[model samples]
Target: MRTMSITNARALIIMPAWNEEIAVPDTIREVMKYAPDCDLLVVDDGSTDSTRAVAMQAGARVLSLPFNLGVGGAMRAGFRYADRLGYRAAIQVDSDGQHDPRDIAKVLDGLDAADICIGARFAERGSYKVTGPRKWAMQFLAFVISRLAKVRLTDVTSGFRAANQRAIRQYLDHYPAEYLGDTVDSLVVAIRSGCRVTQVPVEMRVRQGGVPSNNPFKSGIYLARSGLALLLALTRKRSVLTKLEG
Candidate 1:
């Protein structure tokens, strides 16, 4: 793959939002502030709230789905948009403001040498911490995926990721909508399909607004679901790249 520099490449920030009307505006603002050169798109995953309208008002291009399709499906749509519009790279940022937009350029920089660059937490660069079963599950998943990708990854579940054209095409071919499929399974498939992967350490901040997905009590359930997701990823057939030429 040819090396693409964030300095010159046209990048798209793909924010997959679900009923995040409260957080999307601020997140969009921060992204614009930090990555003024890049375009922003919010994939409204069947949001019943004012997410799509709010995002559009906040100056982001919005793609509203008819119904909720989870992060993976939302992102597949985002990637298709990016590919169709001739974007050189795409960056994934959470809609809840957990991801610092300041690191967007850093993640994109990783793509000069890699097909996919993950913004990682718990990589000795941040104060963010997780404990109990969730921590264990994350560590296990990272360990397994690290070996597969041939890189030392500490946060495989992080949603803050950047992808070049190759990675974007790979994702459209096999990105799944099931639980953990967006983060784990799609990554496993991409790595298996010969995409290079790397990570940059990033600090995770508290969510600015909206309902949180995980609670302390649900850590055990997260563990089981993560393990099953990983198992399904490992056993699934490898993805064959479907070429997307502009």
Candidate 2:
């Protein structure tokens, strides 16, 4: 595995939020509670609610967008911010609070051996379970991406992930805004760019608030769209990070 020392690296927790007024505050608070030293930035992805104000009130730096961009766009903005401010590492946390705040440090620690570390739900660490097409689709993507990345990755679509400086630069250059692009295609891009990837088993929790987005109907669509996204990522031109600035 690629090695790096994050012993003194400045880390940023990037929470991409859209219309998560109810959950964002508690999530931010929990992050502060667990990882108090890390800087927290909430990217309000054109939230139609008071996400921006509430996040700021909850003691996080808020980056507001004019319109709703999906998680991909919000994350792109977050990475750019991290790059500008010289954060050595960044971890993506859901504002809806499914990701456990206590695991933030574990995910960041993954940067010690890999450019990107994913907090995997199905890595035999948690009781997280998925049924039907979603489960099948996740398995297929994990298998394909593991081959491409040359690593045993059990959860390629996991949003709870961390990136070191190298991976952050790669993300800034190629992070996509398409459906499933943030998770699946983005990882493929990083792998193609010569970034090392790995995963840490993490438990998935029920959302503290907001309606769950996944359903039986959406699972079928996710299966199809995720496959297409992976195909496009594989066929897309490779962006080799020859000499990136830290």
Give me the candidate number with maximum TM-score.
2
Quality of model 2 by C-alpha lDDT: 0.90
Task: Name model 1 segments beyond 4 Å from true.
Answer: 1-8, 242-246
- Tens-place lDDT per residue, model 1, 64-134, is 89999999999999999998997889999999999999888888998878889999998779799888999
- Candidate 1 has what TM-score? 0.94
RMSD (Cα, Å) for all candidates, in order, is 3.0, 2.9
Model 2 TM-score, all chains together: 0.95
Q: Cα miss at 123, model 2 (Å)?
A: 1.0
Per-residue lDDT of model 2, residues 1-246, tens digit only = 222245425899999999999999999999998887689999999988889999999999999999998999999999999999999899999998999998888888888888999999998787999899999999999999999988899999999999988888889889999999899999998998899998998989999888987899999998999899999998766666766454
TM-score of each: 0.94, 0.95
